[model samples]
Target: MADRMRKPAEETKADLDKLFLEKSRVKETMSDVLAKLTANRPKDALQFIADYFQSTFEQSKRLDKCYRCIMMTHHSRPVYQQNIASAFDILNQSKLGKGLYGVTGSIFDELITLILQGTPESHIKKMTDRLSRRRYEAVTYHVFHYAVTILAVYKDYLRVAEDLFELLDVNSSGQVDKVYADLLLTQLSTTFDHFKKDCHSGIQAGISLSPDALHTTVSKVSRNATGKEFIDCKHFLELSADVYLSLLQPPD
Candidate 1:
């Protein structure tokens, strides 16, 4: 009897260890989702959260982390992610299924890839220029959110990526200057051709422009480039309401 009892205790200990290990994975996955949420890629962030829940469900066949998975998964939706309090509530709840997780995870994976490809360097420059005109308008707020959302949803939707970047591209020129260029050229080849091109472009452009022209262009772009131009976070909240309402409207 004593030996049998001891074996059961050992088994229980092993189970606890496994459970804790899975919990650790949940924590890491949660961290990853939070990071993505705060990044330029909210959709990708959502997908990451979804993927974690899905994977955990499949592997563990347990509900311990389901609440978080559900919360993050729901929050990834553009509408829900915008709401801090509601998102928090959902994140606080129960178990998710393995099958559901797998499907959602695949969807996110595809979206992320599409968004990334859409915003190539050349496209970004052109799109920024096109969209910069709305900088001072009320529409600018919607436009900014729209751009970010599009980037999130389309993930590498190169055509739309180009359009968004062109709208943001204040310079209206074909190339990115060295300073703004860094946003485009994140990776460096051993030859560094991309970096060199950007550097050369900025220097040449800087030299060619009169100081006044350069200052005007920079001023225009700088004023709205950082997210500070947004009157409040709620600007998007309001816009989303309108957009959703529009979606619900009857077909023309």
Candidate 2:
């Protein structure tokens, strides 16, 4: 992934100037469109805010894309401050937008940072109250930076995802085994289904299990069942795959 924080000071300065000019042009165009729309029927402030946000994102994507392409620039410092100010401006213009209770600067930071970190618009919508100017900025900034650190350390969210999957796989088999697998399937049917259908298909055929499953499986298989003893990692691996298969194709 391209580094968002690698831009030089000079490049950032140049980019900021260009971004500002483009934003001004877009604001003018949006004003004209809104004026025409409100000519006959009056729209509430929230509706207008929503419209402006949609249009702004559309028009601003060019600049946003450009910013994404380049490394973070010193020039961006001022622009970033300005953007925060603009976000507040939108919030102040709407009645319902401002009436949100418990809104804080941290929340605004959190919401905006999530947006910058590529969180889906739908997810952001689910957090509309927290995303307000007062709250998002306050809550998200530090957390978002931490999220960025995790991204940097792991290289990608999918890698973290892989780690989580492995943690549940137990037995080093490509899948969960019968007992543990059955429990997981019963407890998280939808998640289990989605995991197998989507997430498991591409994982390396190796298994790792959650803590309790590991202890139980080890205890059960070592119970002096004589010929049924599990001796090594290979045994564990086979057990895992067997568990996975049984869950996937249980007899009716």
Each candidate's root-mean-square deviation in Å?
20.7, 17.6
Q: Can you write out model 2's per-residue Cα lDDT over 208-242, one digit (the tens) per residue?
A: 23446445655654444343322332333333333
- Tens-digit lDDT string for candidate 1 (89-145): 332231233232221222222222333343444434333433233211222223323
Which one wins on lDDT?
A: 2
Q: Please list the residue runs of candidate 1 whose C-alpha ends up more than 4 Å from where it truly belongs after superposition.
A: 1-119, 134-140, 156-252
Best by TM-score: 2
Error of 1 at 68 (Å): 20
**Each model's lDDT:** 0.37, 0.41
Model 2's TM-score against the true structure: 0.24
Model 2 global lDDT (CA atoms, 0 to 1): 0.41
